[model samples]
Target: VQMLWIPFWAAGIVNGVGHYWGYRNFEAQDASTNLSPWGVIIGGEELHNNHHTYPTSAKFSVKPYEFDIGWAYISLMQKVGWATVKKMPPKLQLGAVKPVADEKTLEALIANRYEVMAAYARGVRQACKEEIAALQARHADVSVLTAAKRWLHRDTEKVPAVVLPQLAQVRAAHPSLDKMVAMREELRQLWLNTTQSREQLTADLQAWCRRAEESGVAALREFSLRLRSAQA
Candidate 1:
């Protein structure tokens, strides 16, 4: 809501007081009328009945010499390229227009809007799944490091040759244990950044299962078992 006020306090006071004392300008059977020659300064004061009679007129002042303050502001805004006024079409201007949309049309519009939104949501979910896959791959490499540490602590001299190459690969992939730890932190932050609601998460999980098949299920179950074992 925007409001424009005239500079003069007397104008404002007259606007408030003139409504009851003014002479009727139209035969609308209403008690409203015009107050003064400078009707613009007081924003068409006491002209309710005249407005009811000719609501479509851009100018509220019925008389040629009457001034309209609201029109002055509208002119200023137009000069500054800040406003554009579009007059209503002829039928609507005459108050003869029917409703643009019926119940079924409105329902179809709403359904289409939801369908577009659902497609956008599905795209976001797919992007998140790709990011999660990258995180899981990083987690796998970190798990290898963790396994290497366990083996190292058990007996560093007795470490197997087959596992030695795998340990070296893990070490080469992640220069330090701290790098793997940082990757884990980054993965957690990425998960936190998701805008997915509970319903969206459920949908994403179901989609992921469909895309990844048996490998996805086995990997998730193995990770779950490892987490429980670690907790124990």
Candidate 2:
């Protein structure tokens, strides 16, 4: 029974369904997901996406909405001096807006890239709402947006191959939304390029922020302000 439960259930089910289905807390590079926010089964392994995001974290649950039973047990052990925790996930904080994107801003942006991108996802959703309404007012074809909307918040590589044409169409139709999506990729490049010096990245970030704030898109401008306030 132990052999079956540990090897078969734990090894097979968690690894299988964990990669295949469920909501993601963080957009981990791989397809990992939380089995449930109330992670009651298989210790804390149900919070599989959280596990992938912070592989070394002893506590699996990160969000306020999530509850990991294994983390509860770990806390109990900690109270009894039976356990010790080491590394946990990094936090993304927002402080007073900086005058410019400096070295510290670059460091914070890179350190919390995933969280930063998730916040950018919110800005993308806003772009969607604004663009969709504008298109409706003009009586234009909204199918392009309907296609692009599903994948806009996701990474470029994660966008479905078939939907690529629709995304292109979206760009052609809506100039404001086009600028937002293109800027999203430009923002991602600030961290993706490794050869650039810290100073160079800071300059690049400053340039990016200047462009965003001046882009004429209200959502993009607000997002730049939020980006300026990010802290490590």
Candidate 3:
């Protein structure tokens, strides 16, 4: 009964609290998160976000601070000739490249696109918060600013239609905030352009970098430069 109950209970909580609680390493479309970095209990299934981030990987731990006891057990089992590791996540290799993105850049982008978006989203959220705080200080307009911050990272459909006006208002009021939000969308759309040819994509990326730099948004320009140099 322990065997029956334990796995079922673990699965339920992992699917529940794992989605509702803890810090998300990646801003996944779904609200999946790591229950804990030290995944020793429940056979290391606590690292659910890492599992979702690299679904094919048998080892769930991704960071230096993380530990997957299940992976350790699998290694021990392999050493005793009772198990075998099958798959792992591919490494994201970003290297220097020409001004235009190449095949290697596309490959690397495809492999780690989610990670790229996650980082962009986090940066935008931080910038948004700082902007909102400044707005609240200057105008004592906590309600609108607070709502803007709240829905900043949510899925577009999840945000109330009424909040759209407030977002536009905030954007009009803050140049830096607007630039961060627009840059995030541009980065997302760049990857979504499947119809574009390789040459077109490379050209688009180069154009994006130029616009980003000219916009005078420090974070956006820095990220664009990083993207320009990225390769697989």
Per-residue alpha-carbon lDDT of candidate 3 for residues 1-232, written as tens digits (9 for 90 to 100): 4345548756788888988788767656677789999987677778888788787788988778999988898889999999988987666666774576666676676678876766667666777777767766788666776778756655566568999998888778778878777766666666778898877776676677778878877777777767666667
Q: Select the stronger candidate by lDDT from 1 and 3.
A: 3
Ranking, lDDT, top scorer first:
2, 3, 1
lDDT, candidate 1, 1-232, per-residue tens: 1145533533555435544556544333243456665664456543544454455655565556766666667668978998775641111111222122223322232223222222323333343344345658766434554455433211224457778765565546533332332222332232344575544443443333233233333333332222222210
How would you order the candidates by TM-score, starting with the best?
A: 2, 3, 1
TM-score for each prediction?
Answer: 0.28, 0.89, 0.79
The runs of at least 3 residues in candidate 1 whose Cα sits more than 4 Å from the true structure, single-residue gaps closed, are 1-19, 46-48, 88-232
Number of backbone-clashing residue pairs for each candidate, in the order shown: 3, 0, 0
Residue 85 error, candidate 3, Å: 3.4
TM-score for candidate 2, residues paired by index: 0.89
> Which residue ranges in model 2 land beyond 4 Å of their true spot?
1-7, 136-141
Least accurate stretch of 10 residues (summed lDDT) in model 1?
89-98
Q: Is candidate 1 or candidate 3 better by TM-score?
A: 3
